[model samples]
Target: MTVALPSILLVLLFALNLPVAFAIAISALSFFFLADGLPLDIFFQKMVAATESYPLLAVPFFVLAGSLMNAAGITRRLLHLADALVGHLTGALAQACTVLATLLGGLTASSSADAAMLSKLFGPEMLRRGYSAAFAAAITSSAAIITALIPPGIGLIIYGYLADVSVGRLFLAGVVPGLLLAGSLFLTTWWIARRRGYRPTRPHFAGWGEVGRAAKEAVWALLIPVFIILGLRYGIFTTTEAGAITVLITLLIGALVYRELSWAKLPGVLRETVLDTSSVMLLICAASAFGFYLAWERLPPAMASWMVGLTRDPQMLLLLINVLLIVLGTAVEGTAALIILTPIFVPVILQFGIDPVQFGIVLVTNLTIAGITPPVGQMMFISCAVLRVPMEVYTVEILPFLAAMTAVLLLITFLPGLSLWLPDLVMGP
Candidate 1:
């Protein structure tokens, strides 16, 4: 009754369109008042404690760095580079959109932001080139899922933080899977473009000179991910320190190298960062209180035990988890789901001898896929709105891309080495 009441209230609040943070906070607070001997002060303490962690500082720093990079015109250079590299292919604009999203994934780490940017930048261009608005909106929104699987992904950071796993390893582990996703989306777009006889954006392949110039222009932005990985690997900085360092590097590049970010624009970028950070951190705070309630009731271990009883095999257990996460991802906000569910699932997976790092990648990837799904998909709505496409059209066009994403999810789920190889090679298991 105690658990059911809060769970039901959460669903009701979500249906009522309440903010996820308040829904969680309100539902969680109900537990203290309803349950005997539970003190209200503990709930307040839990929310405060959640934001007090040194590692949690990475959230705001990375969010600010991403905003600064975009405001400084890094995204334009990246788009140009993506076009130079892939703009001659069949469905050239679509291909470039995928590639650009992959690159921006390393920079922005927000799938919705990537989707919104691509929709505005390439959406109309694709339409002008005879591509359907649905196709453009679908690819733009779906490909942004790549951002959540790449290094410095916000989802990866939050999952790592909640699961008590190594954030560095999580970042290292995401590289191959992220690329695989990009490639899958690229191939899917190519197949569709070829079948439909869609014209290429460029009349000819980019010359070496053009490629070199594009690369040179985007080199500073390209180095951000490499710098972060190297910094983490060589003990130059902790994960939190890396976020701070990234902000410093981005500010320098924006002000001096690119010379695009002006003093007047700085305030706007900071405001965007604060807004993004506040939404995310507030969810974290609420989830912390809710998690405390769940812990008090011993729900995590109980759920783990129930799940373990269903299957002893690690593979089967993971498959079940994938199913659950996919459903939850479609319905719940990914960050809230990550914070609330990680506690319950971590113990279950550990008992099956699954690596937390590998599981973290899989978890983040699955939830990110949901960001483009229907009904409540934030990215879906963003793309549809920016492209002025109907939801039904966008949903239909997204089917194949969704299939591709699902395939990648299954591949990562079953192949531990795919997620673990780079991390193990670099960090040593």
Candidate 2:
């Protein structure tokens, strides 16, 4: 009966539409109080144990760094560069939106943040340029999903910690999949823009001179992943340290390099970072307690046995897991899904010889894709808010983008080599 407390509270909180972090915490608290066999002190112990992790240090640093980058005007410069590069192509504005999102996603870990920033910057312009408001909203929301598959991705970080995989490797594994998704969205945008007759903003290609100028402006912002991977691989720092370094570097770039960081802006950055980090950290703390409860209830073992009984073949198991993840992604927050499912699925995936880092990519991709979906999709809501478009309108317009994303997800799911090769090559074994 004590073991059941966590699950019961989980259901009750979820039904009440409580925040994911609070739900997990409340459930864990219920278990602590209701379980006669278990001591309440264990909950406190587990909470300490959960946060004592060395790798977990990366969470705050990365969040802070991402916030700093946004403040530094890296996102704005990157968007300008992306616009210059893609604005001459077919469906120029639409493709530019995708390109800019991909670039910004690399710098920022939050999809909602990316969506809000991009939509605010480009939404009105898209409408004025003859793109439908719904289409603009759809593109903004869909493009932001790529953020979760890029390095420094919060979703991937949470997944790595939950699944007990190396967060560094997960960061590297995300590279190929992120590019694939970006490319697919680019093509989809082109096709749709052609059909819609969206006009190009630029008349011709920007020469190397212009490209170099743009790259120069964005160079500091672009080196973030390079620094993180190198630092992690060479033992210069752990993932957590890398995240802290990212924040420091981003601040330097914003204040010293870009000359944009001001005293006034500092307060806002701190405030926003505090809010963002608080939300994510709470989720982690709650997940810690809930994870213990899951083990107490023998959920992982039961799930493993059930999965194995359903299908012993690795390919079939992968397929089933992918389908389930995709479905869950639509309804649950990506971070929540990662926390809950990572513990349950890691053992089963390892049993089938699936690469944990590769699976992390697949999992994050599916969840990000779901952000464009209807009903509970946060990205959908953010995009709509930015563009002031109705949900019904954006849903119809976003189908092509969704199809493209699904294709990318399937590719990553079936072809592990695509995700693994880059990590193995760069990180080496």
- Roughly what TM-score does model 1 have, to 2 decimal places? 0.98
Error of 2 at 406 (Å): 1.1
Each prediction's total of clashing residue pairs, residues at least 3 apart in sequence or on different chains, is: 0, 1
What 10-residue stretch in candidate 1 is worst by lDDT?
A: 328-337
Best by TM-score: 1
List ranges where model 1 is wrong by over 4 Å. Answer: none
Candidate 1 at 393: error in angstroms? 2.2
Per-residue alpha-carbon lDDT of model 2 for 1-429, expressed as tens digits? Answer: 556767877867776778878788878888878776788888877766877777777777777777787777888899879977887898777788888877777678888888888788788998898989998898888888888877888888888878888888888888888899899988888888888889889889887788889989998888778888888888898887787778888888888899988778888888887898778777777788888888887899999999999988888888898889877776677777677788898888888888888888887888778788876688899989878888888889988888888888888889899999877987897
lDDT of 1 by residue, 1-429 (tens): 766788789989888878889999999999888889878999899999999988888888888888998899999999899999888899999999998998888888778778888899999988888999999999999888888878899889898889899999999999999999999998899999999988777888898899899999999989999999989988999989999999999999999999998999988988988888899999999999999888888998998899888999999999999999888877887777888899889999999999999999989888888888876788898999998888888888999999998999999999999999999999898
Residue 106 C-alpha lDDT in model 1: 81
Q: Which candidate is the best by lDDT?
A: 1
TM-score of each: 0.98, 0.95
Q: For residue 364, give model 1's deviation from the true position in Å.
A: 0.3
Runs in model 2 deviating more than 4 A are 1-12, 44-49
RMSD for each of the candidates = 1.1, 1.9
